[model samples]
Target: MLTRHFLALLFLLAFAPPGTCGPVKILMLGTSLTQGYGLPPGVEIPALLQAKLKAAGVDSKVINAGVSGDTSTDAASRLDWSLADHPDAAIVEVGSNDALRGIPPAETERSISTILAKLEAQHVPTLLLGMKAPRNLGSAYVRSFDAIYPRLAKRYGTMLYPFLLEGVVLNPKLNQADGMHPNPAGAKIIAEHIFPYAKALVRKARVRRTAK
Candidate 1:
């Protein structure tokens, strides 16, 4: 019986899909910021993150699922499709478009809540990246919108990066001509700030993968 079991294990290992026993897949689900917007292909946050991980000796595949102009509702609607990749973990950076479009904060909250719930159901470790509404929005609106991320993070027990554009939001050097999406330099800053949190998610993924 021991000999047969050992042989079975060997066979499974031999035929396992590439990367199955190696890097974990991390899905970056967000908007144009995550997609790189007008930035060049290799300068996007996902690509920068992949490079960061490699440099740090962490093996992982960062999948970019960002879509320009996608609101929180849009993200919620396509989450099932995103989950089809069976990501070991996720980093959610949505809601900016909702704020920009003046969508109700409650609606944004609901959509993001649904996203967190779905990810939790799948046992995928998640990192929620918060977005502050434009200050031009009334203080009340800003308060409500800003509160969504921490509240959802607490509720879902997920890691929370307070702001996706932290340290890169207003500076002209960091922003593109549109002053919305980050420039390559801005993207690099984002990747650096997000690296530690993402690394934590990778660790959690590994633990969960091992348990299974």
Candidate 2:
């Protein structure tokens, strides 16, 4: 029985997923979503993403540079400071706050475009996570804001994840009491959905040296 148990344990560990190789710094710049407003410490989006990467044998060190309620303009102003870590790659999640605040789409586009340009200047690979305007914002606003992401992605030649809150938004069970931010479980789903893109960034990071 002891020998059988030992073999079973060995088999389990063989498939048990190895931790990160070293530490490939990945910066997550955004607002409450990345800040993990309603989630617990280890359950935040960045942390959860780190865990997912590690499970896939990636050594991702996700730096949470999120400041809740920060708009695209706000993120633009703080871009330099936020890049202090000199991450190998970045995931940009700003602009949603701007949309919520009813900022003009052109203004939002300009700020986000500038931000992407700065990252490109640093030679840091980036993944832009998009957000759609609420339907109540009206069709015109929706068209403008919704088009901002693809437009920016094209202009900057960066990878774009269509929507950040793909399967979680508006799902009460996946959201917290306020229904804006996600709960822990919801955070996990986000991490999973974004993992493929984030993993590509990791691979890019591995080949490239740290950003100056």
Candidate 3:
């Protein structure tokens, strides 16, 4: 009888569903930054974020859906396909490429808005990582570009990280040789900065999932 009970427990622990024993599933959506361009796949922000969340005692899985050079338009188009993987939550971090390519802030906003709407429709919670343009973009472009994230986060009721590259962008040592992407150290900084916010998003999503 004891042996049978132990075997049953082992099976339950091994094959239990997500809510039972394993971590929550979170989909991270973005561009090269999220994809860890110029760096190994596991060194990206999403993986580091997962590590941080685990450290914080929240069991969670962060799926990296970042594609190199993906613009807001690209992300919007791929939203459905990405969500088909059945992530419990999502973090959106596009628009940098759009800003870099000078793709018109209005178009970027529209794309992000569309993406958020689709995620919302699927009842997937989300976190938005906003991006800012270089001062060279001029005041008009800056205002338009910077407003897209907050506007969408508010409209969709999602958590927003004002600047995805907050502490890592300006640091030369943190950035890669190209000065566009972050090295592993820089990715760690980003993970640390975004960890709490991501944890909260995950916890909330878990609660909602449980309620349902």
Pitting candidate 1 against candidate 2, the one with the higher TM-score is 1
User: Candidate 2 — worst ten consecutive residues by lDDT sum?
Assistant: 13-22
List the global CA lDDT of all models. Answer: 0.94, 0.89, 0.89
Provide C-alpha RMSD values for all models, in order. Answer: 3.4, 7.8, 2.8
**Residue range with the least summed lDDT across 10 consecutive positions in model 1:** 15-24
Specify the poorest-scoring 10-residue window by lDDT in model 3: 15-24
Off by over 4 Å in 3: 1-21
Q: What is the lDDT of residue 52 in candidate 2?
A: 88
Superior candidate under lDDT, 1 versus 3? 1
Model 3 compared with the native: what TM-score?
Answer: 0.90
> Any idea how many clashes model 3 has?
0
Q: Candidate 2 clashing pairs?
A: none
Best by lDDT: 1
Per-model tally of clashing residue pairs: 0, 0, 0
In terms of lDDT, model 1 sits at 0.94
- Across 1-212, the per-residue lDDT of candidate 3 in tens digits comes to 99999999998778755554457889999999999898876788999998888887888899999999999999999988988888888999999999999999999999999999999998888999999997798999999899888888999999999999998887899999988899999999898888989988988788767766
Instruction: Encode model 2's per-residue lDDT on 1-212: one tens digit a residue.
Output: 99999999888767644322357889899999999997778998999999988888886789999999999999999989988877878999998888888999999999999999999998888999999998899999999999999999998888999999999999999999998999988998999999999999887776666221
Per-residue lDDT tens digits of candidate 1, residues 175-196?
A: 9999998999999999999999
